[model samples]
Target: MKILVFMKQVPDTAAPISVKDNQVDASKIDKYAASPYDEYALEQALQIKDKAADTKITLVTLGPARVREMIMQGLAMGADDAVIIKHEPAKHGELVEPNDLDGLAVANVLAAAAKKIGYDLIYTGTKGVDDDQGWVGIAMGELLGLPLVAGARSTEVSGGTARVLRDVEGGKEKLEVSLPALITSSQATEPRYPTLKGIMGAKRKPVLEWDIASLGVAADALASRVERVALDMPPGRQAGRLLLGEPNDQVQELVRLLREQAKVI
Candidate 1:
């Protein structure tokens, strides 16, 4: 079985966020890392590959040149090979802003790539950690004319079909689909970190790079569905006040502060 896992490099969630010229300022970020949910998808693929003989787990990411780091990390975690969809021009070291590519364009390019190389199953995060645009997997499925199950918590494949369990409002929903399907993974088992040995071995693994033109996608045609009119940081938080003394006294003081100073009842 050939399983394709889609991933992305996003700004580290713990890093400080700042906006400049309506785009995230990369300089302020401490580092870039793989989107958390994408890692879960990768882990799921790895788990399956561990038990299934003749299975190959290949990772694909669409981003700027720096995205190679994210792909290498996945390689270190045991993916057989990787494909980097170079979003930026062959400008060498420079990285394009993540906002430059939207979900529609990403889905289109991914669908095209999948067609070029057939897969028994495809996996992706339900949404990207940075943009939270949860459209790519479903859109790719639509473009590829394949069945898709979103928010899958667990998946099991057998007899040329897959059984997926997904969380819902009150319970979980079970679904079975034939081969050549897509799954948007949600919260599941924790992702495994790359070991030192794995990291050393990853350096020898194959990492293929391809440009947007090579993917048969036009640069200008990827118009974003949502336009950013302005950008600003959220208001900074104020220092908190401590209420000392007895619990009853604190409750009374809190009420007074809420009524008089806060002006909320």
Candidate 2:
């Protein structure tokens, strides 16, 4: 089986975010890592490969040159090889920051590339950690005219069919999709760390880099429909107040505070 896994690099969630000129100050972010959810998707693909030794997993990413580091991590995690869609502003004039592209635009580029590189199944995270927009995978499925099962907790494949289990409002729902479908993975088991051997082998694995023009996608088609106007940090949390008294008195004071100051009552 040939499985394609979409991966993304994002600033570590713990990294402090600062806004400058209504945009994130990338200079302040010192660390970057794989999108957490994408790790889950990659792990799912790796698990499938584990069961079927012949399965081949390919990591696909659309981003700037720094994303190659994230691709190496994925390769270390057991993906056979990787393909990077270079997001260079000089080459692709319309391309600025790849993350700024809207879901439709990003999906169009990825879908076009996915067509160039065929796959039996596609996997990606349910949402990116940076934007938390869960639209790319779904939009890719639509653009590719393939069935998509989003937020899958687990997946089982056999005889060209994929059985997926996902969470609904109250319980899990099982879905059966034919081959050549897309699946957006949610958290299931913990993602595995790269073994020493895998890390060493990853350095020797093949990596193909492609420019936007190579995909034959028109620049206008990849133009973003959405624009980020500004970015602002969330308000700082206030310090909590402490009540010192008997249990009954504390309860009364808490209620009074809630009614008068907090005004939630």
Candidate 3:
């Protein structure tokens, strides 16, 4: 099976968030890294490739030129090839919220690219670590007119189909679908990391680059569905509230508050 893994370039969650000029000021954010969740998706594809010798794992992403760093990291992990969608990182305050960009435009370009190559399987992380929008896989599925099994905790590909188990709000859901499908893996999923030799060999693999002009996802063709109105850092957190008293006194006071003041009861 051939696979395409959808990846993202996300802010290093480790870096503190700073808001300036009504933007994230991500330019100043230290250590841009692969979206943490996308790491799991990359690992998932690698594991499948290792288990199936015929499988070739490919990576694709839509972002500015700087996104190559994450794509290289994905290559170093075990992807056989990569595709970078070169476009300036559009300001969220100008267009749509960063999370909401997982729509027809981006999805159409990815679908067009992947369909050109003809893949049997596609994988993406459950959500972008930065925005946590949880839409790309579903959107890709829609654009490709394929089925999507999302938030999968585990997946096994066999017999020309994929078996997936996903966690819903509070329970698990099982799905079996034919090949040439899209799946989003959750944190609960486990995929093996690239070994030392695999990492070394990755340097020799292929990475295909394409521009918006080549892919036909021109800016004018991408109609905006939403626009960002404001951007700001979260307010500083307040100190914690502590309720203290003897055990019996605390219980009595809590009960009184529940019944009379707080009215929780």
Best model number under TM-score: 2
TM-score of each: 0.86, 0.90, 0.83
Using lDDT as the measure, name the better of candidate 2 and candidate 3.
2
Per residue, candidate 1 scores C-alpha lDDT tens digits across 1-265 of 9999999888888988887676676667788899888998998888888789678989998888789889989999989999888776232134335557677878889988887767999999998888787998889999889999999888899878999989999998999999889999996689988989999999899888887678786665466676777767888899999999999999999999999999999
Q: Between 1 and 3, whose TM-score is larger?
A: 1
Predicted candidate 3 versus true structure: per-residue lDDT over 109-213, tens digit per residue = 778788777889998887887766677678889888888888777677897999887777888888999988898877544545557886777767787778767
CA displacement after TM-score superposition, residue 246 of candidate 2 (Å): 9.7
| Residue runs of model 3 more than 4 Å from their true location after superposition | 90-102, 188-191, 218-220, 240-265
User: Cα deviation of 200 in candidate 3 (Å)?
Assistant: 2.4
Worst 10 residues of 1 by lDDT: 89-98
Clashes of 1: 0
Give the CA lDDT, 0 to 100, for residue 176 in model 1.
96
Which ranges in model 1 have alpha carbons more than 4 Å from their true place?
Answer: 89-96, 218-221, 239-265
**Residue pairs with backbone overlap in model 3:** none
Q: List per-candidate RMSD values in Å.
A: 3.6, 3.1, 3.4
Query: If ranked by TM-score, best first, what sequence of candidates would result?
Result: 2, 1, 3
Model 3: lowest-lDDT 10 consecutive positions: 94-103
